[model samples]
Target: MTQSQHMQIQKTVFIITYGRSGSTLLQNMLNALPGYVLRGENANLLAPLVRSWQGLRRSEQAATMRARGTPSGPHQPWFGYEAIDADQLGQDLADVFLRQVLRPEADTRAVGFKEIRWHETPALFAPMLEFLQRYMPEAHFIFNTRAHEEVCRSGWWKTMDRRVVLDQLESAEQLYQDWQAAHPQRCLALHYNDYAQSPEAWQPLFEFLGEPYDAELVEAVLGRKLMHMKWQKPANRP
Candidate 1:
């Protein structure tokens, strides 16, 4: 579709969580909905774009101060920096993401990806989310979480220091909670343990998205596991 058509995309959904948190399950469920195309992880690719936009914004501010109404010229080192429109640049980046990365089809109503790397940079988490909300069209965030103890014992996390893993998981959960508390209308928080086996448990999630809850679909989704890996023991364990 054309860029203008892509810009017409009215709804977007994002699953924000750490790895091994049953996010793939959520992704699959959301994709099952008609006209919904929730993709898998992109390694938090948008984070760097957000960072670049932020850096450019800072440079623009600094240039405004240093130039003091002087016209920027090619002869100067920071020439043309003051002319940059950081907001437009940010919007263009978001457009590229929607058209190229998400690549929603003609029938797609909602498009997004489930990313596990948001917690990797605690300092940038809020900024990155803010950038998305500002640029992406009608963005909605789904914060997925598993129990900290369960997460620490799952997959590769089992090989890491339990205390460290738990701390990271808790910290990420706190960030999700804070964001959701601040934007209740645009956010939904889901716990894997709470809804992993119960279709009724997912009613609120469906309601939040304004999608009809399909019990049969939910049951079918829960019947199979996505990205399930064999348990890995810590290297030091006997």
Candidate 2:
């Protein structure tokens, strides 16, 4: 397939975060902008797809190493890491994402989704980021975070989901930091507390996205009674 066939979207924006980290709010805000529609989470599909690919690579590595009588030694699981064709994997994943996750809309100049599982599946971040960088040249990433304690206290965590929440958040943050360091212009790190305190605090994000900042739209969406829990902070208090 041609390179453009694999990367059909004009611009792809990913809001990567742990659950209960205000990614939905970020999505809503971005969607309010003209020609931008950042959809909700798709971890149910993305996580399993990524895990299966990793498992397949590991299984192949084990089979190959055993057949060749090669000692796996300390890095047994990643024994054949170098043998994996990342470019081919990238192409496959790009096709999967375009087919499964994104919804095509002619009016949408940028189409994207928010996914929380990137935190739990930290190993997939680098490869996926590389793939995104290669295929979707105009891609932007928003790494949203809330306070660690706040996340732990949130409903999502309190409901018996044990995925090493803190560790996952830390690892995800590190991934975001590393990616942002390399591509400063295309990555944005945002804090839920800051944005919740003042929806207008997201002006920098709008600026980074080259979208006009609209305080009214921010207030309109944020002021409503939504399904998600209230941010519990005074609006414009900060």
Candidate 3:
């Protein structure tokens, strides 16, 4: 497409946080803007490599690494210090589906993703994060958080948000926290309780996006008038 006929420059806001940490709520909230789309938590790509990363833990005390040269593998990692294979590169199929189904018009609005298994191995997945950073240069990110206790409680519910909740199968939270602290301005810290209970505190979300908040925009993106879609009552609610 020509520059004049271009869609809104895409801005990816990575919602890197503990799952069930209110990403859906945030996704719903942000997509309300006229030129924004939310690609809910689709980081399944990192599933294969996390195990090997554990072997390298003791070597680097460095914070986060940067992707200096072009990653020479299928993965085409945006930026980071990881041994990636070019064969590892694959487009987020979700992006293709979105462009085709949800955003056919390709509105001038930017799109973003809010998905993670934060309690999982974040350092191992750094390459993917780097790749995204390259693809979505306009991307800013939101790292949503909740007290570990609250996450546990909510995670225990019947319709547990598996994405937000840390499973017995995954790595601990300290690693996630450390990886996060490694990258500063690129992210914002948002708490689930704060976002759920007091929406006003999230004004910074709008500010970071360089847009004004629209009450209507928030409602539509959030699927309107519902606080926490009662998913089979979160596993075991009375």
Candidate 4:
């Protein structure tokens, strides 16, 4: 499809979390919803696209500087890609995502993906987050987190240093917190323990996404283990 053609995205939802943080379980529950479709861990696909965009801006800046007889340096302002029409770019991105990463099903009402790697370096994820925000202003974000000690004990962190793991988790939590603070209407901060202890905790999530709460589906999803990480109750759970 041509970039000029517009894609009408009903809703765009992003699931953001660090590894072994019950993100996969949340993904499963979100996927079970009637209108939402979220793909898991597409960092391999998304990271390249964002980096390529950065590269393209650098190249564009160099060429523009050459044309203006100005020396381009590392300190030059990043080109904003303002030349590209916002709506067209947004639609083109949607097309690329749906076609390449997550193909739309017949009844797909909302589309998005989940990735844990973004939490490792939230700074690197900033440009991509900005891209999503600018293009899909209506997009909703779910910031999922698990207890620090519990995450450190998980198999995913077994080989890693506990201190480093804790720091990374803290950084991830802070990134999400900042985003939520800045755009409360567009983000939801959810803890894995809270959701596990009471499945009804997902009511806020469903409300955030403008979806009907399906108690039956939630119960069904909870009945079985969807992700490899088993539910771990936190020490401070009330």
Candidate 5:
């Protein structure tokens, strides 16, 4: 098959969430699928790429303004900027990310990674997500969340202020809800509290991705613990 055809058939899924949201477990489950390659965190590298793409788009707008009044000259500040194709640059940047960062093998059918730092800047979340959808091939997003109280008590979160962490978690989940409401077909919101113990809970996720749900595979994936701390139910009466 041709390269273009290969790319067209390949799917991409991103696990978007904050830290200690059981994303590593989700990543492991996805990687277990046939011909799938879901990677771990990359310290949120795509954010900077999105920023650079936005900067290029702004330059392209400036170039358009410069074209209306003056004749083109090599010495001009925005002279060659007119030739810059922001859309093409966006695509090129996305391709570089796919080829270099999330390097898929020859037989790979789907590829993506889980990232926890997306909630760091609430304002940039939408733009970053939109950019990915615009440039990536058949991109789908899975917004993973967890119980705020449990999350704030896990890992490094114990070192931070409780109210501040809760606020961030709430803000991030709200962004997920807003985006999912706007584009239901492309987004899936999964809560750790709902699926941490049961492999059957992930059936809807496989259905959303148009993948066959294998119970045994799911069971095996769930059997292995990927996180440093296992999720424990709070002792408070239900």
Candidate 6:
């Protein structure tokens, strides 16, 4: 797309939230957007000093850790495409992510990172919002959610580890409440259950991203049927 055309699309969506919240399903849906590039869990900036950034959202997490005088927690990994260099990651994440990887995956006007972590807590991710506004100045964010009990259950099944499961449950709700209060307009909150329950649930998100809901696209990306269901790796659940 040309510069004028790119300006018209005017959206780069970041899926910011915890695991086991149906983010993958959302990622799949976003990936299918006409010409948009979607890179899932590609945030590597949460670490001490990795290069390619996880994106503006992870940049916020990095700022949070600095303020707290604490190191990045273990569960919060520095995720990204292995092709990226640790040093040049952050400042250029969006550029590289768009040009090298995501663009090739889907041909679209907008592109984004789908990886997220502990920044789920608004307080935790406070640093991120400001960073994102400055970094990919054109980017937008999505604060995704699911029922607490269901999140816990799904997290547990996905993460056999007791500690990870516990953390997700404790953090998920707070993250939802926190990000919403702090960053309202930029952060669009939605439940994973709705994605499974009805096509209408995604209309707002589609509108937010400046894309129309392609019944064919949604169905093709989210196979089987939309239902109150989920999936996760054993490590992801608590």
Over 4 Å off, model 4: 1-8, 55-94, 227-238
| Clash totals in order | 0, 0, 28, 0, 0, 22
Predicted candidate 1: what Cα RMSD to the true structure?
A: 3.5
lDDT of 1 at 116: 84
Candidate of highest TM-score: 1
Give the alpha carbon lDDT tens digit for every residue of 187-225 in model 4: 888899999858789899888888888888888888876
Please provide, for model 3 over 1-238, each residue's C-alpha lDDT reduced to its tens digit, 9 standing for 90 to 100.
Answer: 2333234555656677654566778877776677666776555433443333333332242122323334344564533444432223333333443354334234656666665564454555565455555444365767676766565666343255645444532353454455568866676777777766554766788887888866555544544565654533221122
Write one digit per residue (lDDT tens) for candidate 5, span 1-238.
3466347437899999888888888998899998888887887888888887788777756667566865558877666666667799889888888888888877788888998888776767888898889998899999998888888888677678999889888888888889899989899888888788888899989998999899999889888866556543322212
The order of the candidates by lDDT, greatest first, is 1, 5, 4, 2, 6, 3
The regions of model 3 sitting more than 4 angstroms off are 1-7, 46-105, 155-173, 215-223, 232-238
Ranked by TM-score from best down, the candidates are 1, 5, 4, 2, 6, 3
lDDT of residue 60 for candidate 6: 59
TM-score of 3: 0.60
Model 2, 120-155: lDDT tens per residue? 556777656655666554888888999987887776
How much is the lDDT of residue 73 in candidate 5?
Answer: 80
Per-candidate TM-scores read 0.91, 0.72, 0.60, 0.78, 0.89, 0.62
Question: Any idea what lDDT model 2 has?
Answer: 0.71
Cα lDDT for residue 86, model 5? 78
Winner of 1 and 4 under lDDT: 1
lDDT of residue 131 for candidate 2: 57
lDDT value for model 3: 0.54
Alpha-carbon runs more than 4 Å astray in model 6: 1-9, 43-106, 120-124, 155-167, 224-238
Model 2 vs. true fold: TM: 0.72
List the pairs of residues colliding in candidate 1. Answer: none
